[model samples]
Target chain A: MTIKVAILGFGTVGEGVWETLHTHHEYIQKKLSTPIEITSILVKDSNKKRNLPDSVQVTTDIEEVFQQPVDVVLEAIVGKQPAYQYVTRAIEHGAHVITANKEMFAHYGPHLLELAKEHNVWIGYEATTAGGTPVIRTIDQMLQVNQIKSIQGIVNGTSNYILTQMTKHQNSFEDALLAAQQKGYAEADPSNDVDGYDAFYKAMILSQLAYQDQPNWDEVYLEGIRTISSQDIDKATIQGQKWKHVATIELRHGAPRASIQPMQLNEDHPLYNIDGVENALSIQTDLLGSITLSGPGAGKLPTASAMIEDLLYVFQKERQQEAQYV
Target chain B: MTIKVAILGFGTVGEGVWETLHTHHEYIQKKLSTPIEITSILVKDSNKKRNLPDSVQVTTDIEEVFQQPVDVVLEAIVGKQPAYQYVTRAIEHGAHVITANKEMFAHYGPHLLELAKEHNVWIGYEATTAGGTPVIRTIDQMLQVNQIKSIQGIVNGTSNYILTQMTKHQNSFEDALLAAQQKGYAEADPSNDVDGYDAFYKAMILSQLAYQDQPNWDEVYLEGIRTISSQDIDKATIQGQKWKHVATIELRHGAPRASIQPMQLNEDHPLYNIDGVENALSIQTDLLGSITLSGPGAGKLPTASAMIEDLLYVFQKERQQEAQYV
Candidate 1:
């Protein structure tokens, strides 16, 4: 059987997903038991020339792409409107959806997941959390076996990059932000990352997964590294500490409470030495104690890799269903 | 649909599996969409007053368990004798098998997997590798999406516990080993773990998953903490480095090579500060860069929890197949 996938955004992550799929087609097909093809792409500009094969149909109209028979929709697009419309349309058409859009997911993911279940499809948001770090899958599976006590980590790469630069080289926040922008770690408009909304959104996802409670984005505490100075770094350093933008969710009085702020971490913490664009999460559990996962918080290839995992999950389920009938 | 499971050992891990199944019965059923009952338990002695329900039949005869209609077999027995025979029998009997037997799997897993596939069965050995760390699950899923560049970290918890004691407290090798045994981290024999064979077997499993190549466990280079000394730790510390018994698989000359030896790592390496009984595996991939997961490598609940995940996976597949028929 063949599966068609539409990537609703032709940006860095979109290109990375395309590149990975192209490079590992045979391997992925062997694993999934069905070949997945990128048949269409929803881009801002249809005139742009990309390295994708001519068989791929690039389109600027979301409705036109939805108008076709699609099996999967990958929402790699930024922002709310058309990306949300594209995914809803795909699910309504009975196609599974995978997304790297954390901002949108944090807001309306539960409703969408309910909708997908109703349609007998799946909403895979593995790429929406901490890049390619399989954190979402781990929580959703392992939490069944163990009670999650707490979750703490650096979820924003831009914020972590800025903090690491300021702490390591004594650079001001502005210079560090500029350096991150040059490295493609930060966007041109960096409010979402530097002001800690990116991290807040990520914490929302983790909090929901950890406790099955989807908290509002504004309800969680938020603190960004935009105001951190060299003096703040030195003060933390002299006290045998380091500064990091940490997204935390813990059970406070038997209720889940979320926080995203720059905290002074001692060397004992697993996330203390997470430097540069790396992100790490310390998941405290009842059975296994503490499990910490560290990796690149955000990158083109890493984020796309998460999407590929989601696609495989979708196909694996479908294949299993087919095998059962036969 | 209903599934019947049998535990073929009443050891620490066996009891853990039973405990997790009993405690999370409703949750596991919800996840797998079926009611799983522990049909029969094969123990060395039925006289042991374990906190099990009266419905769980504890028997000393392995044949008695095989005599009953069983859908899955969870082999938690140690060593090569009855464990290997039991798993082979389970596969031949058309029963899915999940095991926490690393020694058995490392020595004979590839063959057993082939046998299971021939018989249309599955061998779930996630617990066999890194206890409840989910390293096996991560690699199994993520390898489809990305090329594994390298895998390195601490796999053997007993070895790591001894090394950490020696490094931090200047304890002798014997003292550290004693401390480990006292903490129940090391077995009475301790030969398998202290001789580096344990780590070697884990690496062999990882090597196969990373590159589909399973090097002979004996042929793989081995170096245990038996030779590690406080002086070695001091020398490494002088250079701003620390010692960790790293089981590594890197592509050398475009071929996968496995090694388990003590390595000197600076603070920047993700696996550097993983101390005590915590086990960590750093999977470096072409897509996600370096993803390091750290947690309890071996424990009753931890290892048993891994087995539950495997059982869920088995039943989840069964449910998916059943769903397809409808």
Candidate 2:
């Protein structure tokens, strides 16, 4: 089966997905035992001077990509505007969706899930939560029999990187943030990451996947590391504690609530050791008491790797469903 | 669809499985959306006094559990002798099997998987590796889309518990092992854990799953915490490192080989910060780059929880397969 894919962005993650597909295309095809081809790419700039193959089509009209009869759409676009429209339209056109857009999923996940179910297609956003960690797929497939009660951890790589540098090198918050930005872990305006808003969005997405509903996003009580000084780090070290920026989504009786902040971690806590750009999550459940996953939360290849994972997931699931017809 | 289940070996993990069913039977039924009832239990001593419901039958004979009309058989036994026999018999009878025996699976996994496939029954051994951490399930589902290159981290609790104590309290290896035994984390002899045999067995199991065949288990290069002194711990601390008993399975060209020993983990390593009795694994893959999972590796309830997850997976896959008939 040849699975056709259309990419809807030409930014860092999109270029990463493109490069990965080109570099590892043969290896991936051999593993899946199926042929996969990227048919079209939609970019804001028609002439971005990217080193893409001339055989593939590049267009600014997002609708043309969805209309090209592609079996899957990969959304690497950041915001919720055109991403929402393109994703919903792709689902409406009977195409499976793979997205890394957390903003759209956080606000409209339930609705998008409903639409995909109605259209009989899979909707995957594994990259929306923790870059490349397989937490979403693990929870979705493995622990289906168990009830998830909470998901707590460091969900943002920028904040984690900043905080880790601040504690390890005793750097100030500004210096750490600048270092993260220089390393491309943070954006020019690091408000979304440093102020805990980025983690807040990820928490919202996690709550929806684990709890089947939207969490109280506004009541999440977001606290950033802007207030965390070197003195605070020294105090924590002296008191035998580790400072961690944690985003937690708790489910009590099926109602979901969340909190994103910096907390003093005890010596025995798992997150106490999770430093830098390494992201970690502790999932508390009724059956499996707690399972933690930690890894790089943000990287070009890691983020693109997650998208490819979701892409394969959609195609594999479609194959399983189609196998029933035979 | 009523799924009939039989319990094999009424021991710690077995009792935990039974207790879990009794306490969360309703939740399991609702989550699975099917009727599940324990029909029989195979015990070493049939007349042993224990708290169990009157509806379930107890027997010392393995044939009684396998020859009966059961849909699934849960094997919570720890050894290779009767577990292999009961699993083979259950598979021959075309019944789905769930096991928590790492030794048996590590030795005879391919044979069991082939037998199950021939009989059109599922063989689930999620608890055979890292208990309750969902390592097997994560690999089976998520990494299916990606190429797994290496799996490295702690896979045993007793050794980790002792090492963590030594690192935190600056205790000697012998004292830490004694403390672990006092806290019920280690056995009286403590040879299996302290000698790295337990971790070697788990690495074999992980290698089997990751590569679908057992690697050279004898060449695993086993080194336990017994050889790790406080001097090594202090050296690691001075070098900004942590002493963790790490089990590593490296896969190349689809062949998986493993080694379990103590390594001076770098500060930036994800497993470096994972302390105490916690077990963590870093799965380096083509997709999802480097995904890590950490949690309680062993305990009555945690191991049983992994067994239940396997059972649920078997049930769901059974349902999905059976739905094709309708």
True contacts kept of each: 0.83, 0.58
| Candidate 2 Cα errors over 4 Å, as ranges | A141-143, A252-254, B170-172, B229-242, B252-255, B322-325
- Candidate 1 chain B: minimum summed lDDT over ten consecutive residues — where? B212-221
RMSD value for candidate 2: 2.4
Query: Considering every candidate listed, which one attains the maximal lDDT?
Result: 1
Per-candidate alpha-carbon RMSD to the true structure: 1.9, 2.4
Write one digit per residue (lDDT tens) for candidate 1, span B51-143: 777887789988889888899999999887878998999999999999898888877887898999999999898887878898988888777
- List pairs with backbone clashes in candidate 1: none
lDDT of each: 0.86, 0.82
- Each model's TM-score? 0.96, 0.94
- What is the C-alpha lDDT profile of model 1 across A78-190, one tens digit per residue? 87777787788889999899999998888778788889989999999999988988899888777767789899989988899899999889999889989999998888999
The digit string of per-residue lDDT tens for model 2 on B140-251 reads: 6555556778889788888888878888899898888889988888888888888888888888877777777777766568888777889999998889888888888887
What's the distance in Å from true for residue B239, model 2? 5.4
Please state the error at residue A175 of candidate 2 in Å: 2.3
